[model samples]
Target: MIDLAPWAWILLAIAGTVVGLSKTALPGANTVSVAIFAALLPARTSTGALLLLLVVGDLFALLTWRRHAHWPTLLRLAPAVAAGLVLGAVFLAVAGNAVVRPVIGAILLAMVAITLWRRRRTTAAPEGAAHLGTTLGYGALGGFTTMVANAGGPVMSMYFLAMRTPVKVFLGTAAWFFAIVNIVKVPVLAGLGLITVPVLLMDAVLVPMVVIGALFGRWLIPRIHQALFDRIVLILTVLGALYLLIP
Candidate 1:
């Protein structure tokens, strides 16, 4: 069994709840959960453990938003995302926790800046369709961050927002994107010895919290104004990033 302090368990439970809420309603908020898990567990182990809980959250998101996904966009992003996953796997194999944590923090901060800049530049729809360069850049970054530390939400959220995706469509597309990407990561993490019997057992205990958060997200999403929702996600994302950076 995995040993954890009482306070750690309490924090993990809150993190699990946030994972579900992020999937179902707030797209970038899971960065906070990632920060919590990483703080409380071994960095690499936390990635694997959080990935399982995220997959569970992904399922609920998919069920709720599957119909809203934009397939063409997903297809466009596929190749770059795959390349990024491979790169991330390589990075994970060699980097220690000391290195990984700071890198994750940097990526999150960068994404937040990019998101704010993009939002300021345009409330209008993206000029023409998404360019190939833009697609590849966002796809690869999203894939790499997600694979390394489950921090892809903010990166891809910025991508969708830059494209001016409507709230429902954005949720749907992101739901499918993360669902498939996260599942693909399972075997890679398992091969790294990050996913193990104990991790699964721990996740089993936390699954219900994820479900509750998802349900809560579903109820809350429709009520939030889009502008307010976007600000909240970005602000939470910044805070999460800072947590990783601080000792």
Candidate 2:
């Protein structure tokens, strides 16, 4: 088994809970979990361990929001996402976490800024659907960031915000997207020898916290107003991105 200090375990448990809450309620919040895990473990190992927990969280999100997914959007994003995943895999094979993390942080910060600017464009005509180029750009970046650092949530959250998706639809589509994407990453991580018995054992200890967080999210989501939810997500996204850039 991999050894960790007591404090590390506590941090991991908190991160697991945040992962669940992020999946079900706040899309961008799990960046905190990604930061915590990477801080406490080898970056590659942390990515694998956290992937399993994210899948568990994804299951909960899918169960709650299955009926709300918009398949056409998912389909439109697929090709670019696939290209990004491949690019990320190659990058991971060649690079280290020190390089990866900062890149992700920069991308997230830029996306947040772009999203906010898009929202403020009062004179822009309403685009009924996201532009193909926009979808591909965000999808590719989301896939790349997620593959390297588990930081896709905020990237995609910015995309959805720019698109002006309804809150429920945003959550629902994100739920489905992550669930499928996390599952796809499993074998890739396993091939890289990142997922192992020690990681699984650690995850087992942390999963109950994820369940508790998911339940809390279910209860809390309906209570948040749309405007407040939007602001909260954007603020958290910015904070998470800044945290990544700091070190």
Candidate 3:
């Protein structure tokens, strides 16, 4: 079982709450929780704890939007995502995020910059190789970042944003996608010695916070201005990336 100081547990609870909502309603806000949890705990432990909360959030998300998912998009990306996950597992077995986060963050930032630039240039959405390549690249990177720091939100968010999905389909598809992925991570994290019985126990104490946050996000999401919400997501992604890199 994992043990943490009181303050650390409190901080984790808060981060978990936001992460829950990010999964269900605010698709990009995950960067904030990743930054918060990584800043407060050992990178490995933070990854595990965040994974637990993600599962909780995943449950809420599926319950809310299970029917809304775009399964074709998810399937199209599955093979690459699996390849990325395998690479990420190998990386986590050898190195920590102290080296990974900065490199990955720089890459994510570059991707976002390129995406934004393309948006202004052709007035067309990102597509073809660049888009699919980013999917493959970021899929591995996403698994790596989440394995190390729970920081994949921005990476995935940028991909979804570039795809320019309608807001509801975007949020709904993300909900189902992450539900499956986060659950898969559980056994992986347990094998890595990051998840213990005690840690699971502590996680139960914080489940309520995740629920509340998800509920709040559910209510708040549809009400938000689409463009403004997307921009906020982008800014948070940058901030979350910076937080990990600098720390």
Please name the candidate that would achieve the greatest TM-score relative to the true structure.
1
Per-residue lDDT for 1-247 in model 3, tens only? 4567888778777777787777667755666676666666566666777789888888888888888888887776678777766766666667675765565455446545654564475436566434667677767766665555555655666566667766667767877777777787788888887787777887788889999889988888768776776687678667756766784
How far off is residue 217 in model 3, in Å?
1.1
Please list the C-alpha lDDT of all candidates, in the order they appear: 0.86, 0.80, 0.70
- Which ten-residue region of model 1 has the weakest summed lDDT? 119-128
Ranking of candidates on TM-score, top first: 1, 2, 3
Better of 2 and 3 by lDDT: 2
TM-score of each: 0.91, 0.85, 0.79
Expressed as tens digits, the lDDT of each residue in 39-145 for candidate 1 is 77778888999999999999999999899999988999999999999999999999988888777777778877876776676666476578889999999988998
Candidate 2: deviation at residue 70, Å? 0.8
Q: Against the true structure, whose lDDT is highest?
A: 1
List the lowest-lDDT window of 10 residues for candidate 2: 118-127
Error of 2 at 216 (Å): 1.0
lDDT at 40 for candidate 3? 65
Put down candidate 2 lDDT per residue, 177-213, tens digits, no spaces.
9898989999998888789999989999999999988
So what's the TM-score on candidate 1?
0.91
- The TM-score measured for candidate 3 stands at 0.79
